[model samples]
Target: MQRAQRNSLRLLQWMMAASLALPVALFVIAATISYTSTNDIADREIERTLDVAHEHALKVFETIDRSLAELNEVVRNLSDDTIRAREPALHRRLKRLTDSLPQLKSAWIFDADGKALVNSLASPPPALSFTDRDYFYSHIDQSIGTFIGMPLTPRPPYQGARFFSVSRRRDSDDGNFIGVIQASVLPEYFESFYARIGSDPGSFFAMGRADGAVLAHFPRLNHDLRLDPGGPVGQQIAGQPERGLMTIAWPSDGIERRIGYRRIAEYPIYVSAGLETSAIRARWFATMGQHLVFGIPATALLFLLLAFAFRRTQHLQAEAAARREAEDALKHSQRLEALGQLTGGVAHDFNNLLTVIRASVDLLNRPQLTEERRQRYITAIADAVARAAKLTSQLLAFARRQTLKPEVFDVGQRMQSLHDMLATLLGPAIEIVTRLSAEPCLVNADAGQFETALINMATNARDAMQGKGRVIFEVETATTIPDTPAPVSGNQGFVRVTVRDTGIGIPAARLGRIFEPFFTTKQVGHGTGLGLSQVFGFARQSGGEVTVTSEVGQGSTFSLYLPRVPPDLRSQRLAPNTAPAVAGSGMSVLVVEDNIELANFAADGLTELGYNITLVDNATDALAELIVDANRFDVVLSDVVMPGMTGLDLAQAVRDRGIGVPVVLTTGYSQALSQDGAAGFDLVQKPYSIEELSRVLHRAARLRRVRDGAAE
Candidate 1:
């Protein structure tokens, strides 16, 4: 019996050691995998940053080169005396070009003697000599296509700004070098762009000459720092001369970083992007910390449970029941707490929002308010109205029931227009970068909703980042969506608008339900959780899709995919209507609405527009009037939802009774409109301006008149 007991004790010891070893081994493997993945992601991000810089540099250089070529073509055969004589015309041309391209600060034409003949900076030309300028000297002896020189800060009489010169060697008909034509490129342009793309602690973007002269750097250095000719990056550029990546300690700060460098095509310029190695490792550690937080506790709990079972085997059944009971009670308490928090969160947000309008109204009611204060109160009321409207629109959008008037528009062009607006809305603290595709991204979507969706995403990004970060809008054409299970049909292409933000990202466990209305990860009263749902619904209603990808501490990317409108269909749209006469000239109209105030308002508004109006409270009475004499009214206007019969049903009955008067419908929200969509009739959304209503009604009336005339 003693021997048996000793053996059992030894077996239990071995079991405990195996259980502990398994968890430790699994954890080690997980950590290794996590570290490798984190580094790989960081490397890709660095490469992408390099690509952006490279593309930007290439575009700017190409523009400068083209401008130079144009100048050469004009002056290659003209003598120095003729060019000098025509300096006035040339200066105007240069000014126009500079004005057209924001990248250029100025343009200049220098003679063989290195004397400036024409420039965009001043009316005629500054009494400046280019003999000592690097751009002029570099091209004097070489047949280079374009010589991009180092950055220089100009002296007095010129703007105290830094810019780099891009020049080409001007040659005569006989291939003899004559002079140099150069454009001054604003370094602030590139620096501003760099600031938008990356905003991390040790992020850097640098452009330099092949000979290691620094042209520009973002997070601009106080003093110039050139790349070492013998350094890893410089040596690679010297050898390969196209593109490369390396890890090295920066000479300026001795900080180790992973850098990616690329040469602008056939130009002696290079753009390099670097991210600190320590930053990358810190990100890795953050990821590992999350894992450890969950894993260590879980493993300890399992071990404790196993030891308890071994020590108290005889009492295991009773303890198991007690443990299960405690878990149930805890889970019940958590559920109640979560529900209460969510309910309170929604109520708190709405109440706070309402206070703005309420306070403004109370202030405006005061008798002795000053004009300035009264105006301020009025402005406050307007702003509150707009916010309330936005909130309602968001909820309606999430419900997929908002009335949408879709039209074919270029998505890229729209994005370009929003650049300024987004910059203003996001404020100075956040940078907005856009990488719009040159190719047309035409989609049939509601323009207003499209803007709203983008704004929602940007606002969410701002919150996630704590109001200060980078938001990048990248638009491109794609045939396949990466996160989808299967590719969309090949015949139909998609315009993918990606909004990427550097923010504390959504947790993986919560990503699946991000589009569920009222489900949010934000703190209480911060959000209603309807923003992403709006995006999801708009994409779906427009026959598109939305997807997202994120890492815990890295950031999130929300991709909105919309179907590209076919070229043939775009061409088939009807021509714009001829500007109609504003005066209704006694054209009769019947208005049907459920609300008495709305009916009277429409009647009064239409009468002002010179249209005679017959108003009714319900569609049933409106139909009786229309059936009496269809020709009495030029058009029938009705609301979609009414007491007995809907406006849509009334229109259908008008047709069934052989009444020929055209019918127009209006609604703030309706299931019929959402599902059937206007039903082959003109529609005007409710709360529409009088101008919009007049135009829509006039169009319908004119169309009816034409139909009657054709029949006659």
Candidate 2:
């Protein structure tokens, strides 16, 4: 009987092992199939999404191009004075042109001095200046048939509002330059077109210039949709468009999305489509859940049968191990919470110091100092400001507050650009080696921030090397693998930027805390402990991931896996220096500032610069003065942040009351204002010197005077 029992027990043990092994084997097979199916679905969905987005984007571009062509034709016809000389014929043609194309807001002609001669929107053509307009200056000398300009805020006779212009030079019968025939397209036209693009709910689209200046958006995501060059998607879009899919984490929803972007063929604009992983995962999860539900019951029955016949000692051991792991995870969470509290406090205090330094530097640029003394003071102030800027940059990097401007460029080229600067920054102790990829591998990132990140990484590497070891910078395109320490996005393809150093390797204990702000291994004064944190923050912010591999005796390698900028977007650079002129003369001005110190400073500066100044403490006071003498203030210069009324409110009120004063808003927190509001008012960023203030005020005054003069 005892021998029989032993035989049964042995047989039961074999059955139990087979049952457990079969379920696990089945599970592995099912998971593999599910993963493969999910990926296939994702691929198909991505392709479809891209196709739809591409089509819609092309449609919008084609419409604009068509509108431009029509305007060009009108300009060509209007160039002949014989045709324009017949007032009734010209008026009828202009009305018919505007009626034929609803998108065309108004058509007009401007002489050499920017005086408006004829306009479709005006009864009797109102006189106006085009000298300050982007379209006027940008395309004034175009030898072509027609030139389309970037969108601008319209002024005079037409009412101040945003509009895109198409201009063509008028020529006499002998081909001598006479004037320009221009057409203005309203913002509403673009808005209507965008609305018809059929975007899904929770999805938005924007059209912007290569420089990140937003031209239009569908359903308008923000009041001002200026693509922050420092923002993740903006940085990614900054690259060439041909390279294909660029995966990034969407900051709005904190979801990993695969973005396929393409730049407009002829224009300096990009169109991108974002596909959420969760959307793809939904189908995969359902398939997996259905498979699991069907298999779980059968597996449970098999387990029960085996359990009845077998010893249960092994099940207890696995449960005990899981419990220990759970406890460890709970402990780690507690530690993270504690560390977060500590970091938050430090960051708050650091910000205050930066603000004070920035303010002090602005105060130092007063005009009272002699040229020699001013230059010396300016140099010192600039140096201090730069250091403070770096500090704020680091803080923003750590906090993920800094926006990214992603662009596509050769890794080698970028590295070469920084070669001398890096060498200077690192000093002679560290030997730098570059192993850049021969094929230009494009990375989508803010060039400035990316350079800063690279410098920070190099600095850390140099420190690790103890000023006497080799620091190698390497670039290569790579594919990621699952079940490995890779970026959280789960993207297969990436551009790897590796910074390896032969130095004192990080200890196991310190490795985990290396990315924590202010968690330094070095002496208190030697470091702020923000370098690695900034690097980590930058990587995460850029829709990429970073990892460090090191050994106690050997050196360390910091690998940054950034999303590759597609091949097509690699050539798109920000619009080259198109700075607006600061010259404006012979104009009356109104300076409204609550701060007596700043107001008086600005007023005195404007008065010296030959501008008639009317100073007020609030927007209401300015409004009262304007109402009493409607034609007194040619330009209203008001503080953005004010006690009684804001600059925006003041400007709106002025417009509402039909007071035609061109508003130039000033603010210390220019960065904080909405882009639309900033664009609406010709803004002068604060902490401005008397000269800087004078220049802006003079320009604003001139523009206002010109507009008012045209009205009269």
Candidate 3:
């Protein structure tokens, strides 16, 4: 009986052991298979990502090569003309073309001695000497198809922005190198779109020379690429095949990563895309987590199953949650980066503007400064202020908060008036083509806003062209009626003004949101991103609309439509252009103001303009003076606001007295300019330029002349 009982116990123990061992063994096999399969998928994903990167990179190279080839052809054609380099038309054409390639900083024709002759940038680039440059010397030393220079800053007068240039040898009939046609490009342009190229965040995207020197790298470590002995992108791929992948530890950051690099065919360069090792393993680990859960039932009978699998199950869930967090993190990071860039750009540009203002101010304060030099500094100050004001105007316009006084005007005529000024705005690199209609395209809009909008569009067009291209300003009449299938902006007679560019077109992905405020395709500081927003606001506010149509590699067109009015509509005459500041001719001027400082300032300015000045602190005081000697003053000038009665009241009182002196009210901002007591009187904005003040006073004086039957 004892022997039989012992046999039963032994058999039970064996069965229990088999049950646990068999299930655990199966679980291990399944886990291994799952991990292997997942890794294979991860490998394929890497390959797809790499190919996408490669294709995108190839497109960039193709664009540059095609552009260069087109330029080369241009040179070949110009070879027959000996003085082509000196031709203004040819220079203009070259400049326009170079500006079109926004990446290119400047385009130039250099003589055999490497003297820069005609440049696409405005007449003869400042500090045009280039013989010292290696790119120039390289062609001089030997013939090369297109030699690219290392990043460099040219010299003084050209501010310190790092640039690289591509040069093609211009040869004589005897095969001796003559002048070269060169285009300088900012290296940042090549790397600017790297983040959008489907490469992983924090991974390196690099363009390298055949000799394993880095040309450009995203997340720029240096304005120029540098060589590091501890290779992240260089030596590891020096002798690699035309295409291959290698893993290395990134020197800048301690992350181990795998890189896929391709040698650019037909060029002595290589491009690479990298991926972090930890990121790769995340997918593999996730696969194991899934297997652990799936294989749990297979080993349920095994009480002693491996502890590590359970830990990973928890880890995998946590990683998934962390991944969700990471996505949010990515979005936050991008926003921060954009904000940082925005602020950085704003500071950079403002600093440069401020530097000019500061230097001008300093020069103005110098005791021994020549009158001519003082005038120059003053002019510089004025220019800087105008530029700053324009910047402010854009901000206000974008916010739709600026006070605008609309007027009836001919759109075609307005564009014509602005033609010369717009040319200066676009520089010599761009062609301003105006197609003004013979028939007047009449519209009622604020002249200031109208000009600003036009400038904004033209500037945008200039940017779209990368600095060079044809910008067309066209004005035509259209009729928009409510309930029409194809309405011309809607329910009114419309005058359409289109600003079109023949430059790089907008991408389809970005087209929809181009009108959004603070959204831009421009590098930080280069644009406020408010330009189009201002256009949108101006159009909508003006009882019309603006529209844009674009395609990649083609160009862009922005059409601004405004409601049209009859030709018979009496247009408000723009303040006529004053022919320089004229002597006041001893014209007696009555100056009234609430502030003592402003009154004195006005007196000084008027006195300098050759006017006899009677300064009063307030309208009440001014009125007392007027009663004492009404006809003694030739014109009445007063500040709009005062402690007693306002300038408007004073003007009305002067009229009540039968005084015929024309009153001009000056204010920075006042609703009273157009209010009850001030109707039909001339108005001048405060902070007026001396020229502006002179012009307004002369107009007032002319008004007196006209009323007296002498005619204004």
Candidate 4:
């Protein structure tokens, strides 16, 4: 009987081993499949995006080449003196052509002396000598067809926009180089197009010249950025010359990527697209994790049933692991809570704005409203729109996109002016105090952003104090800052502004992360956590620093340090232009709007402004009307966001077809306008008053007449 029992035990041991081995083998096989599949998906996606980048690069360069050729042909036979004499007309022509192409930043024609004779950016190009420029030097030596040069910022007097030159050598009849006809192509244009197509995390798209000059890159633009010709991408081009794929660590950032590169057809330009290897591996891990979630639990269950001998030991281990998992889950939940708070806070603010707009519209629709009440409702609607715009602006500021309009101002005086406003904002429960410097505390910065930052700090103080505390605004000159805590004595060139609050201070653990976006100690409904981040970004962007010191339950002090400017350098602020609107005297307008009601509203408004109006519901119809008689309308007023084609497309069509009418675009908001910026056409923002619309339309109409007169 003992021998029989031993046999049964051995049989049970074999069954337990089989159960464990089978599931383990299946799990390994499944994981292998998932990893391979994920890598394949990543490869396909990278190659597809590369193909798109390649096509876009090709199209852009080809258009630029065509523009250069046309420009060359126009000026090929003209002498320098003759070109200079005809520069006014040629300047207009260049502007017209350059505006039609969104990729072109500006166009220029240079004399043999390397002096710009005409440019699209201005009526007469700035009298800057370009003899030292690489583009000019490249053509001065030889005729290389279209020479693609490295990116550069235009010299002073020009707005600092980075551009890569696509230039053709202008030759005399005897094959001697005369000058260069150059088109400055915006790298941001290519980056914007790449962004629209979308990208995964760590995905990269770049357009570069064969000579290692990086013309454009997504995520950032640097005029001095370049690629090494000896790198993997370049070596692949050398071996393949047309197109190929490889895996390499990017020399610029040391990131391992699976890269696909293509050389533009017979041109000295190459485009590369890459997907991060780490991202690919992460995807593979995620897929396998899902499988393991189920597979491991099932395997555990099978093991417990088959091996009663080890069941108690496994149970104890699982209980210990469960407690560890609970801790990890709690940490993960805390992180998710911050994201939930941000989303809820943004939604709440936007909803409040929407509520005001909706209620105001309802009130305005009521019958027999008094003119004063109507104006009040209209004003309320306008205020809501402005507030919503400001909210978005703050978000953009935190994202580091807010364009600062810096000017010299006295920080002390500005703070003094805001004393009453601060008291009102903080409420009667909170006492407001100011300790401004008796002397001037002048600084060059964006006054609006500074005010916003101050308000953010004040509101944070109010929240910290639970709406009952003392808030102090102090401005003074500092010889040293936190960054240079012990500067030499009397080196006083920094203006320091402090906002100190008597309130419950921040915890040491959380203080370091206060400036991070979406991280806040406040409850979910109380804050969006973007205010402090905006303040941080504005400080950094303005060439300053903001530092805070806090002790738990002992109040907090926030200090901002900005470089002080001399009193003599304080800039004069421009007053608002409040001139009366110019009436349209029988001018004809073609109004294109997708919304029927809006189209009628605009037509009626223009008609009341003494203009003849023809309305259409889409860009296609507007183009048809222009095609029938482009000269009939003095200005074409169109909504930017439209069906079948955008108002931008309509404007381009008008220009491309040599139509003489001026196109004025209107929009509340549009991605196209934000990206390419009206493409040199006049733009009037929506929610415009009738007077404002009349002024814009009249201005465009006047330009049309002037152009016609110039032609005559």
Backbone clash count, each prediction separately? 0, 24, 2, 0
lDDT, candidate 1, 584-643, per-residue tens:
789899998889988888888889989999888888888888778777898888999987
Candidate 1 yields a Cα-based lDDT of 0.83
| TM of each candidate vs. truth | 0.47, 0.41, 0.44, 0.42
Ten-residue region with minimum lDDT total, candidate 3:
481-490
**CA deviation > 4 Å runs, candidate 1:** 1-383, 429-431, 483-490, 518-528, 571-585, 608-610, 655-658, 706-712
Model 3, 192-301: lDDT tens digits are 76666646544567776665566677657654455563464556655565877777775555578766778776777677777677766676677667766756665663
Candidate 1 collision pairs: none
Answer with 2 or 4, whichever has the higher TM-score. 4
What lDDT score belongs to each candidate, Candidate 1 first? 0.83, 0.68, 0.73, 0.82
Per residue, candidate 4 scores C-alpha lDDT tens digits across 576-643 of 33556667789998888988988888888878778999888889988888899887888899888876
Per lDDT, the best of the predicted structures is: 1
Q: What are the RMSDs of all candidates, in order?
A: 40.7, 45.8, 48.3, 43.9
Task: Sort by lDDT, best first.
Answer: 1, 4, 3, 2
Q: What is the lDDT of residue 148 in candidate 2?
A: 55
